[model samples]
Target: MTAPTAPPPRSDAAVGTPPPTARPSLLRRVWTSYAFRRICQSVFVVWLVATITFLLMHLMPGDPIEIMAGRLNSSGMSHDQAMATAANIISYDPNANVWVQYLEFMRGLVTFDLGNSLTNPSKTVFEHVMEYLPWTLFAVGAGVVLAVVIGLSVGMAMAYRRGSWFDHVMTSIGSFLTGVPNYILIAAVIVVGYTMLGVLPFLDMRGRITAGVEPGFNFVFFGDAVFHAILPIIAFAFTATGSFMLNMKAATTEVLTEDYVTVAQARGLKAGRISRSYVGRNAMLPIIPQIALQLGTLVGGSIVIEQILQYPGAGQMLMAAISNRDYPVVQAAVIILATSVVIASLIVDLFLVRVDPRIKSEGQDA
Candidate 1:
């Protein structure tokens, strides 16, 4: 006993044992999470798009400086005078190296500082973009929401009434609408409604808001804005609704065939209760992600539609920028459009966890 006690209780340090490891911090855990990884991927894609756009514009045929100078010369300035003015107006510096200009551009992008307009030097590109972006967001956003809501209802009906005349009619309409391009729809409206029928009041709806209608929180101003945006909205809705309806119909039909649906039916659950509690909710799981994706793509694709409608939105500004070779403006528009799509996707992921009970249950178990 005395011999055993002679060996004193050895401390961890005395025994040359390693220290216990500390747990990972919350911030570190979050950074390594799947959701965070997805967000980072989206951000990286946006940055890559921006970099490609910058390089492509820079590598284009004409020198921005020379182009600007020539425009000024055409406007009655002498060669020397135009060159000097052009040097001042354009942000690209000929004297500096290409890498230097790229660095500056990237810095500006990171800081939310888009440079001044090359064509119109008075206002910064950010101001111009902000002025027009809201209209596009409102018009496109409304159209997407309208399409999703209507599509979900109609699609569910088609699933329930599978093989009926109504289903056949809707299925054909969906296919036809899906096949037609949105821009073509807009063109057809202009050609038939305005050119031939003279029924659209097309000229009256040419701008974002009517001239005499003062812009305010008042009904008249808002109403006028919506009036002008009607055609663009309608075009987007028709183009998007078909795809949503088809997708929803497919999802619902599949869900209806699952075993749980049969069990619910055998349990004597009311048709309405079973559809809402099980089928519709499950069907919506797939459609929700699509709605998010479609909303984002619609926003980016509104350029031609807005241009045709004279809607005075981001698309109109982008069109003007490209036509005028406004480099900074074009870059800004690209970033904004790309960001909208990526951010929408990220937001939808967050929503999915809330809408989907299985995801929530798994998360709790983990």
Candidate 2:
């Protein structure tokens, strides 16, 4: 009764103006979000990788300390002094329970302390990573970019020309290239360019740059770096382009058959315009995700290629670390690689969600 009486005196602002819209809190929004789940999944992936890497390193044959001691002995230290140095270098009790070591490793990760190199206790894991990561990024990045460009052009041409001789010829080549391993491709390139043709004297068969070229921001230095990187880039691009071409061709072929493309054709749209705005655009959707996902593999995939080329990249560093049984370096490299893959996958997932509404819908549904 009291409320009914008060209703007559209700303010116009309260009655006419709708109640203020209640916005969700940021924390609440994130807690309930698909993106948040994906992020958590990525974090879990990193943790799993770190854990596995740590366990494997510990389980592998030969002690890192022993390996270090042997190297120290070879470097002129007395056997006993080498043993002591090895112990000092490790700084932690290798005989400690595996769980304790894992906890320490996790703690170091939390603090961004990847520990010092077992072989060279003076240099930290981060230092080594920073030293090697850039070269890999440069060579691998150049390769990926070139591969994408070549693939898209070739793939689109094939799709448009379908059963033409050009299409058949390219498809066959792509198939052949895709079947060949990256190392095999690298060896073939080296053989063909340096051995058979002998025309590429500028192609540095080893190292990222000329040995005496001082590292700087100068054109000469950068040009030298580029010169050294050419063969590796070509090798990586040749190995990768085939997959991209095949994927793009398949995607383009499928897209061309869609009703919207058919309707666009019936409307007498220009071939170029239709191809660019309709067929090409739609076809690229699948390829975009592939490109994003492929970024992760580029790091790991470069290992053999880098090893063969003697490129001073992360892959080469990783190989060196493994050979030396450098625990900290190996752990750090694995972590970096795993993190990269997880991050790439996360980026692609988020990108797909934004660009393709269907992905968002599916995420919401899940």
Candidate 3:
């Protein structure tokens, strides 16, 4: 009997393949990556941000003591009380050095003790900022997620069906919507919401709902707040979605030209299957960092949308703090916002490296 034919030699060995290189351990690789360097840079940036924020707040023309007391002639406090309050507000004393004051401020941040609000002495800066941060996050968060989902999907579809009627339709709609500023859209939405839809009242700037009621799922206050949030959310989403859509379209268009995509199509892959599983998947890489960058922008920008909607969100607090020259509030807000931005960028950097190994390898080469 013919000798049993040896199973076909494995092509890798048949071609005299070299032994695989031993890859570095995950931890070691990460330690050497650009991401690690970026994180280190971020720590220095935070310190610099904190120092600059403190100096700027202190340098700005105006006294938190005067702002807090409401006047140089306020009758409630004697000279001693006023001086004590001023010292406390400024974190200074006759005996304390600048280093001491800065060290004390940094210590306070560790404990979430941001001191008293110069804009409103009835509350602490932490309380004032924390109270509104939630609402701002809610509004901005909802808008961003909505924009990404709607925009990316639309853009993918437009790009896939380039020059089709649907593509032209989306392009026109995106152009029109993007042309209108968020404030204008919010105004129109408010008018229609109140006058036409009769679904919700105008946004309340005084605070989220009347002060007495707690925010819960079952209350009219909550309902009213959500209804009011809709217009601002829509306005924010509309203005932002167009950019996401345009970017996604560009990314997807580039991805669709890859040889792998053509090969998949030749292999009898369904159009929908290839689009979602292949093209769309790869196209999302660029979008990831972009989304993080947008998050930073939105955090800084939420105040504008919040003000327009008369929403008692972080934006409103920022506006009030700026108008009153409440250095404490302004400094705290800037530090918090700046720290967030830097952290977001760092997270995005790491995420991109994780999603695309090329980033890590290329970074090493660089």
Candidate 4:
């Protein structure tokens, strides 16, 4: 019986009996986790977003209905006629329910069918969007990339050599420029270009290429298009760079203080290697989400810059639509811009998950 004494209680017992591991099926875990809550939250957000968008048009000063009546009848129709006509154009039939309008708006969005533009006689709202979106992407996208690269590089250098003359100069410059409004900077850039530089960009707030010319990816048109885009790009990039520099510099400084970074240094890693690989990667996590939000903001505000530069981006089109009370065009542009922001944010969330596993797990939980 003593021989059985559990084999002397086995000195290697714990080693043989390892702790149980969690290996829940991926789908099963996700179903019961906070990820499900996040999806529900996103759906709720979309509902609120739709309601807000619908209300935005309603809140504008001049009634689109009245404006349409004025446009349709310059001689001034009777109140009854105007009312009837507005109802017709707006699809405000007496029998129609609020839910019907909401459903219609949602359907139009899903189908990418934005209907006609009341402002632009030459093309449908959809066609107008197609014409302008590319330039916006090219100009804004290039400017963003340039700003991020330049800002990140300078910020990293400044952070690594804090209190140096170069750092002082950059910090001062970034802080100074941060105070200047984008519109003022854009105006100044244009003024400088036209006056000091003696180079005015051929800014035509129309199609990407010259009209009456067949479109092709040839050097002639391509070069001219790029040349036209350069000044606006510079203006946007210059305006955006200060914020990027300041933010990245702050993040880098904060990340440099992290314990892991200290451990990295303790490992005898080269300064360049440690800075580029460790510091830079960690510093960039915060910047990624920021860049996503900035893109959406830039797209929304692009009209101001576009109008000043006379660039035919979607923002300019949106502005024109708003000015004319072009309901279809207005709705289309707003939806496009809103949807872009939502999609960009979603993509950023996914990216954040990848960059920092904590965000993924936490976001799922939230």
Candidate 5:
């Protein structure tokens, strides 16, 4: 029997054209993108923060117009005149529909035009914010940097000497300090350093700079500003450093017990090298994101600390605005602080992906 007629040779075209690869759906592609999710989350967070702040301010007990009227009355205006002037200055009808005001406010936010302050109509809210932003940035930025450095070093050392007296002492100190409120710490510094010992003669307890120093980019101004900032920085750093140190200590302790650490030790790696490469580097990963978050929070000046020190910063401005019931100033400050936090978190999320590619993989899988 003619050997079962061999099947006709398959045409090359039949084999050459592979099944068309399935293209990813547009929705699937978007959902899987790390940047897309992060941006959406950030937008949602900003909107939530803004909306909540607006609602709370509006629903609060005191009336902004009444508060302004009281201030005008203090400035020697009759009750009727004060109310009329308050209306003129604010130019916002308290009798207007709440929804209408909200729409106007949202419009201003979209345009980045935070309107003028009711208290100081001559200068815009943005002007007030700019005037105080730099001081807060300088003091808080310096404090955060100092805290990170001190905390990382001390924490690593504590981890290296776990169960030793050094570790116990530091841990106890950090725990105690972390429990103390920032305002309390500032008060203590004022009482002990200024009131009790009178040792810090050079310390300017109030304001960002000494009274006579001209505002310019010179050694005198620079030195005076730094000198004035020393106490506030110390207060901030001391309280903040404790939390950082404790966090690092815990992270390091956990990392030191990892399999790789044991392997490094078993391989007879130098202690310093093992600590640097296997322990320190890995331990720092958790803290790095925290550092970024803290730096972001620094934009919102420590309200209690700034108020106590009378340092001209955003916190001080906010406190003043709240007292005066200046809606624009208050809203702008909250928006700026909230926006900074959201943006910082977004940046840190992206940065973490760069620092560790595994994060990107994990994000994709999620």
Candidate 6:
């Protein structure tokens, strides 16, 4: 029987080979991709937030058209001209059905054409946002950087001296700071310095920069910008710094118990060297995700801070828009804030995958 021909000598390619797995469809593959999902999720969240804000703004008591028309009349425009101009600026018809208005808003959203503001008809909502959002971002960004540096340093120090007086004192300070809202802290400072101490120039500190400081890449403008932004920056940093310090301390303490850290210590590594390379490094991994969250939160929370500081950031613009019942601008600001958080979270999620390869490998397996 020729020994059954040994099954045709089983081709090496086929030998011990399992059946080929069916490839996932393009749709399935896209759905499963981490980055794709995150991006889609962010987009959906932004859309939802925009929709909700739109609905709420419409539901609010004031009619933006009337509000704008009244302002135009105050500008000495004829009543007929004022109403017509207001309608044109706001692009709203009081007679239109709510659904039609919604459709129009959605169309604008898709086209990236947020309509002209009721308050500032000369500029589109986007122009207003571009003008102010940068200052908010600068303040928030600087504050987060400063907070991270201070928190990490103080946190690491606290970790090293855990259970000691230094650690206890720092922990108390951190807890207090975190517990207090940034706005309250800012108010307290104003009360103490401007009201009580009569030191800080409250009036001069209220705007974006000194009135005469020319806008440029030069020192005078830059210094003035920093000066105006300082309070908002401190407000942003205070709570975040405290939270970071506490979190980092906890992370460090836990990392101290890890086997590898112990191994590094046993190797006769210098205290500073081991802490920096091993314990501190590993301890910081957890804090990386928190930084992204902190930024997102700060941007969203900037409204209150900016309003209080009279800092001409997106937050201040948003507050003004809301007060003026400027629907388009309000919608823009809400979407911007919510979208920032979503985008930031998505970015950090992707970044974490690169920082730790195991996360990527596991995601693939999933």
Cα lDDT, all candidates: 0.86, 0.85, 0.78, 0.74, 0.82, 0.87
TM-score (all chains, Cα) for each model: 0.88, 0.89, 0.79, 0.79, 0.88, 0.89
Off by over 4 Å in 1: 1-24, 357-366
Q: On residues 84-113, what C-alpha lDDT tens digit does candidate 2 reach at each position?
A: 988886785678898888898999998999
lDDT by residue for model 3 over 82-108, one digit each (tens)? 767765765523344768878888898
lDDT of 4 by residue, 204-287 (tens): 423456665565788887776776777667666775678788888899999999998899899999988988889999999888
lDDT of 3 at 139: 77
Over 1-366, each residue of candidate 1 has an lDDT whose tens digit, in order, gives 355546579889888998888999999989866577768899898899899988876776666678888888999999999988888877566556878878989999999998898877899999989899989888888899889888888999999999999899999988987898888988898899999999989999898888778889998888888899899889889878998889889999999999999999999999999999999999999888887778776887888888778788998898888776788998999898888878888888778976875765565457
Clash number for every model?
0, 0, 1, 0, 0, 0
Candidate 6's TM-score reads 0.89
Task: Please give, for residues 1-366, the per-residue lDDT of candidate 5 as tens digits.
Answer: 557777788866778966667999999988888878999999888878778878877877776788888888998989999988888877766667889888888888888887888888899889988898778778877998899999999999999899999999999999987888767877887888778988866345568778878999899999988987886687677766988899989999999989999998999999999988888888888887887667665555378778777777888889898887787888888888778778877887887777778888887777
Q: In model 5, which regions exceed 4 Å deviation?
A: 1-31, 74-76, 266-268, 292-301
- Higher lDDT: candidate 2 or 5? 2
Compared with the true structure, the alpha-carbon lDDT of candidate 4 equals: 0.74
Residue runs of model 3 more than 4 Å from their true location after superposition = 1-30, 69-99, 110-112, 119-124, 191-200, 203-207, 210-212, 216-225
Q: Clash pairs of candidate 1?
A: none
- Kindly report which residue stretches of model 6 are placed more than 4 angstroms away from their true locations once superposed: 1-8, 12-15, 19-31, 71-85, 361-366
Ranking by lDDT: 6, 1, 2, 5, 3, 4
Q: Which consecutive 10 residues in model 5 have the weakest lDDT in total?
A: 292-301
Tens digit per residue, CA lDDT, model 6, 1-366: 445534456665677777678999999988888778778888898889988998898888968778878888998898899988878866766567888888989899999998887677889899988899889999999999999999999999999999999999999999998999999999999999999999988788888888777899999999998888888989999999999999999999999999998898888989999888888888988898899889988898898998788888998888888888888899998888777778878888888877777776787787
Q: Which candidate comes out best when scored by lDDT?
A: 6
